[model samples]
Target: MDSRSSDVSARQERGETGGWISTPVTTDLLRGALDLEHTEHGALPHRLPARARAQCSDGQLAMAEAQPSGVRLVLRTRATAVELDTLPTKVAYRGAPPGPDGVYDLLVDGHLVARTSVTGGNLRTVDMTTGSVETRTGPVGTARFSGLSAEPKELEIWLPHNEITQLVELRADAPVEAVPDRGRQVWLHHGSSISHGSDAASPTTTWPALAAFRGGVELINLGLGGSALLDPFTARALRDTPAELISVKLGINLVNADLMRLRAFTPAVHGFLDTVREGHPSTPLLVVSPIHCPIHEDTPGPSVPDFGDFEAGKLTFRAGGDPAERAAGKLTLNVIREELSRIVKQRAAEDPNLHHLDGRELYGEADTAELPLPDRLHPDAATHRRIGERFAERIFGTGGPFAARDD
Candidate 1:
């Protein structure tokens, strides 16, 4: 019997009625989750496992990993109604009011059918000036989707990309089972906020998600916003994860964060690649630099929020570091690009599978002229689509770096 038939047969054997079945959430039912941790409320999906998380204590890293950028729950059922109870962590800036409620995207049989948001969750307040933070308890909320076709079909509930989700419970009118794997290659990617869907319209519209959709592959995104420095723990996480294709978008984070000097950056990049190669020596790996950020292209950073329209909830960024510091080994987009090219070319002879793509190729000078970044930092929704489509065409297209090996 087929898997769907077996599901029915098992339900009958259990003397079950045509009522709701509360299936336990297991790792098998989760995608885009590198790890799952039990919290006071429920299961918390983490892109980085505990071992790797233990190595870093940065609050930004902690929050970003918990945001569930690409994580989703997948199942197969004939249920007409499904409800998911979750506690989402909502963010609030000290001076600026809270943004819109985070959204949950639902797909049935590979087609987006609905978008919904839960009512209540935890709240975290941040004082960007003082760096003071506070957390408060909140009620749990439910996301209900009814009137689904009662035919055995695959269902995907994408968690909120901008908030940390604590999954409390899941209930469906019919038995639900893990979605059967379709043998799609997994593409593991690591980058900064742009890859984290900060300015992107929705979770599925994130450039990485878009590229994965067009490339016909599953994605594991480690796109930590404001926290994509080449941390050893992050490199270790990338080393351990299994992926057919991998890409690391470097430079912008290092530049904007102003975290390292050129002297330290070269060795850091080399060390990161070395660790990843230890685990997957022959896997196709691509190194991508930052996309066009006019503010930090030639300028150095440690970019600061403009806060010009704080009353209106508008936060934009401006490069703060002096360009003259570049002469003293300070990092800039231009400098990093030159160094990344040299490093990749030097290593390619020994590691033929390694390739480098200047991030500008994805959203370069010309495109920036037409569609500029709203905050002078991250790309907006339209630019996200442009980058995603360009990435799909350049990397996954014929003879591209991510082209299927069989093809």
Candidate 2:
């Protein structure tokens, strides 16, 4: 057996601490999860439940959501040292350089204290030229952290936000238990890559996580990178999940993917909202348009990647659709904003909790000049913080849509 496999076996057999419990990483200890699927390696947390996943066979959607962007494991224990055995799935582009190593973040009593990476895991390779995919299996590895205070603490181990992970086991020097729910309001958010944290420094820095931290809410992030196409299954997933407040950031993905025209877009928005309302008739729901993306603001899209610095390992994107396409009913950021506002206003008469917030209000022309998107597509770490802070202030502060109801 390999050395890593031998070590795991030894720990399982020894029961090392005389009392250190070896906890099976079950769904009960997982937060920000909508579903848990058992795999040969271990338990895989899925952001979308089984019913939703079964309704569609889109491999892109399956992979994007299963990456566990905002998921974390919550445990209450007094252990000073913690070790987690995981089989992470890392992606590799065929022609481009290797992707960055995935990061695991540990938070003690809700404060980030350490960041680490495992040496080995699974690998998935994608060949852009042939449009083919392959995955190679690898042994599980461990991430260890120590020097924490001995006092009982609420510890959270955030899984890699961008990697597909299957949690194998969790071991600590002291016994651990699932953290009890703290009665925080749940915020369910759906968006594209920006909300999924494309260029954020770490998992915890993702805009959704940051906003959840500042707004004092538990986050259920359904930010599917490049797959936020307002699919019926996604709407159904949101409908079934319980939430006090919810928001959907739309536009960029649709335009960039060149998925649909203006004619098909209108009814799709109404239909998506209709599905959610069936389950949550009165929950506050907000519709946010695309933030300021200079390329897609006026021009249409089918964005193409720019490899000008490929040899230097730098990649960016540029819009390919022409500005004249708007006359032919093509979708654009401005067109999306107007349609979303009109739809919300027309529906607000009956749905009292429905609201609309222009994406520009969150990040507009003024902010773009100062905090430009690094890839010409996704915002950088600094911009993410600014957006998250702005979201907290505008959505959860006094007079905000999510402010506590006095009644």
Top candidate when judged by TM-score against the true structure: 2
Write candidate 2's Cα lDDT for 264-325 as tens digits.
99999999999989988999999999999998888998887777775466677888899999
Tens digit per residue, CA lDDT, model 1, 1-407: 63334445755796644686777777999999999998877799999999988988989899999999989999999999887888899999988978888888889988889989987678999987788899998777778788899989999998888899998888899999997887999999999989989888778889999999999999999999988899988999999999999999998888878999999999999999999998899999999998888999889989988889876887788999999999999999999999999999999989999999999999988887899898889898999999999999999999999987665
Candidate 1: TM-score? 0.94
Best candidate, lDDT-wise?
1
Go through the candidates in order and give the C-alpha RMSD of each one to the true structure.
5.9, 2.1
Position 108, candidate 1: lDDT:
93
Residue 146 of model 1 has an lDDT of 86
Model 2 has an lDDT value of 0.88
In model 1, the runs with Cα more than 4 Å from the true position are 1-18
Per-candidate TM vs. native? 0.94, 0.95
Clashing pairs in 2: none
TM value for model 2: 0.95
Clashes of each: 0, 0
